[model samples]
Target: MLVSEVPFHYKRPDTIVYRCIETPRNRWKTKPTVADTILVVEVVSPTTVTADTIDKRSEYARYGIQHYWIVRMANDDGPAVSIEMLTLNSEGRYVSNGFRNRTDDYAAATDTLTPFPVLLTWEQLDEGID
Candidate 1:
């Protein structure tokens, strides 16, 4: 139900999965491993641009996460949750599934937002903002 910070463990001896250290702990009290993750959404910041857009994007794809979303919520030209969606393709690489903005509806690639059957609305995510 919660989008917890989970790491992906690989069979390969040396694989690096990114980690986020700062947290409030209400939502991510339990961390999950990468393999256990169904979807990974990263909220980008200036310091995390390289890691989120490049390294994490590559690693998550390689690790075979079915759904990956890079959320640019703050730096956008306007007020909107600009979502860059990626889905794992047959060749084991992540391909773009197009983009969605705040006004747009994101019915999760998994088709359900999980734990609750509903469209992925901006209001759903805004709950934590206040």
Candidate 2:
């Protein structure tokens, strides 16, 4: 699904907070800051690569997004693969705790997941599904 399609909400003790709920001018909603358990994914392009890697990275960290996946699609090569994964640390800063190049299988830290799983690989991504 596209990034815009995901529903964002803030969870309070007694109610759910929604951003940009009653605004005509605020057509596009900004990222959520509720600190709920969620995953945010951004598909990267040449033009948006820098913004995705730098600007949004800061924003997502500011809002305490648990998992941020930057999917980079290569030209004339293969499907998109995650170039970087940032996990929020205890110090309220995002650390590049995980990464995978075009030739490696992406793996998360064992503490991050039970039984620790490797999510994807270059070969699996390059093999385009029909």
Q: Which 10 consecutive positions of candidate 2 have the poorest summed lDDT?
A: 10-19
What's the lDDT of the predicted structure labeled candidate 1?
A: 0.59
Model 1 per-residue lDDT at 46: 73
Task: Show model 1 residue runs off by greater than 4 Å.
Answer: 1-31, 75-80, 103-118
**Which ten residues in a row are the worst by lDDT in model 1?**
8-17
Q: After superposition, how far is residue 33 of candidate 1 from its true place, in Å?
A: 3.0
TM-scores, each model vs. reference: 0.58, 0.55
Best model number under TM-score? 1
For candidate 2, the TM-score is 0.55
lDDT of 1 by residue, 1-130 (tens): 2223355233221122334435545644444455556667777777778888898778777777777777776563323367676778899888877676665555442234432242555655556564
- For residues 1-130, what per-residue lDDT tens digits would candidate 2 score against the true structure? 1133357433221112233434332543443334333556666778876787888778667766666667677662346554566677888777776666654543421124411344555556556633
Residue pairs clashing in model 2 are: none
Angstrom error at residue 122, model 1: 2.1
